[model samples]
Target: MGTKEQLLCLLESNRERYVSGEKLAEAIGVSRNAVWKAVNALRAEGYEIDAVTNKGYALSQENDLLSPQGIERFLPRDHPFNLIVRKLVDSTNDEARRRAIEGAPEGTVVVAEGQTAGKGRRGKEFFSPTATGIYLSIVLRPALQADRAQYLTTAAAVACAQAIEHVAGKQASIKWVNDIYCNGKKVAGILTEGAVDMESGCFDHAVLGIGVNVKPPAEGFPAPLGDIAGSVCDADEKALRNRLVAEVLDRFWGLYRHLPDRSFYDEYRRRCFLLGEPIVITRDESRVRARAVDLTEDFKLVVELPDKTRLELPYGEVSTAHA
Candidate 1:
């Protein structure tokens, strides 16, 4: 770690109190001038650092900027994540895919403050504005067949819902497949992409991309998404973005480690808001009205058609049907 990173780690660890420039300089083996420079640099990058005569410098509790140090502070000491934080990227999924192709290990995570071309399910664009959302992708080299990849998305949705509720103190529900809703509006989305080993018929690697709208944009959402989109919280809180990122990673990893056991399946089913509700299943050019009944063991949606014909849908866009 460089001077800036070291300073950041120290400041984050002592967020509850101030650290004098003399103490900081001595701890990092740097001069007071260097410490001052680092503090100013962090401020330029949106960190809130208070400088007082006797108290020296203190990081504001409200500094919500995303940083590797900030996230690591909340993660367990034995966590398996190799975290990378970027100010901007085209897409975290794209970045993780590139890293995976180059042989990045499992548990490598790429987090971006903003994404120029954030991705969504079925080639859709996930709106990612800087300073208001969390966009991250994790590289996983699961030893599973290609056909079982849907489990990754299922696990991620449950993890996200749990994290949102823990941090934002709100009820989060899942709209079957991979969308998370809060207060009846879409707050998060998960897109799982991967490459398969052609000969072995197993996944070489999978990238799980999760994007969350932590707060509404300053000018509000775009007109097209105004009615359907929402944020995790009504207003920004102290370290809200960093906390959400850490919580999501912590919860997701807990489920991912025991993926074969399917321990989170029950929670996923309980949080699914579409169960037993009339829904429209859209596949290709056709839309069928069906009542969602239950989820199969593998996470497929079990629906009852109008003629009482039961069907299991492996993948499709679903929406609540209106009268």
Candidate 2:
């Protein structure tokens, strides 16, 4: 750990409690000036640290910056994952994919404060404006067939919904395969891309990209998304982003250890916002109106169409007027 991380650990371990600069320097074996500089750096990164003239420094319960130290504090000391945070990126998913191609191991994470070219499902451009949203992607190498890659997206949806609900104190629901909704509007999206080994019919690696609207952009969303796009909370943006990211990674890893099973299916079905609701599924030029009934153990969506036909679809662009 570097000086800033060491300082962060000390301050975080004693959250909202005063820890003198002298004590921090002594604990980290750094000069007092180094501690002061580290504190200033953390503050610049959006950490809410309070410095008292005589007493010490106190870390607030909430921090806005997505510090690796802050995130690691919630994980094990030897957490196997490799995490990378960027001030800006074209897209975390793209970056993770490039790294994966270069032999990046599973559980490698790429997060950006802003994405210039973030993507949604079906090649749609996800609107990622500045630091108000979380744009993250994780690299995974699951020992499964390429056909089952959708399971990663399903797993991410469950993980994201649970994490948002837990950290934001708001109810979150899954919309079929890739969307998360809160307060009757879409709040998050998941995009899972797989790199397949053609000869083996297996996935070499998968990049799961996630974007959550934690707070609205300064001028709000574009006119095209005015009706559906929305944010999850108005609380501290940095705090929510850090907590949501950490919780999603932790929870997803726990569920992933037992994959190719139905452990996460029931919970996913329970939180699905589209369940029992009328929806329209668009694939190419075909549009089908159906009532989403349930999700199968294999992550397929079961819907009852208008003509009383039951169909199972693995992918589609979902829209509904129910909300």
On lDDT, the leading prediction is: 1
TM-scores for all candidates: the values are: 0.98, 0.92
Candidate 1 has its poorest 10 consecutive residues by lDDT at 234-243
Model 2 worst lDDT run, 10 consecutive residues: 234-243
| Model 2 whole-model lDDT (C-alpha atoms) | 0.85
* Runs in model 2 lying further than 4 Å from the true structure: 44-48, 60-62, 235-238, 321-323
**lDDT of residue 32 for candidate 2:** 97
TM-score, cand. 2: 0.92
Residues 93-196 of candidate 1: C-alpha lDDT, one tens digit per residue: 99999999999999999999999999998889999999999999999999888888888999999999999999989899999899999998999999999999
lDDT of 2 at 77: 69
What TM-score would candidate 1 get against the native? Answer: 0.98
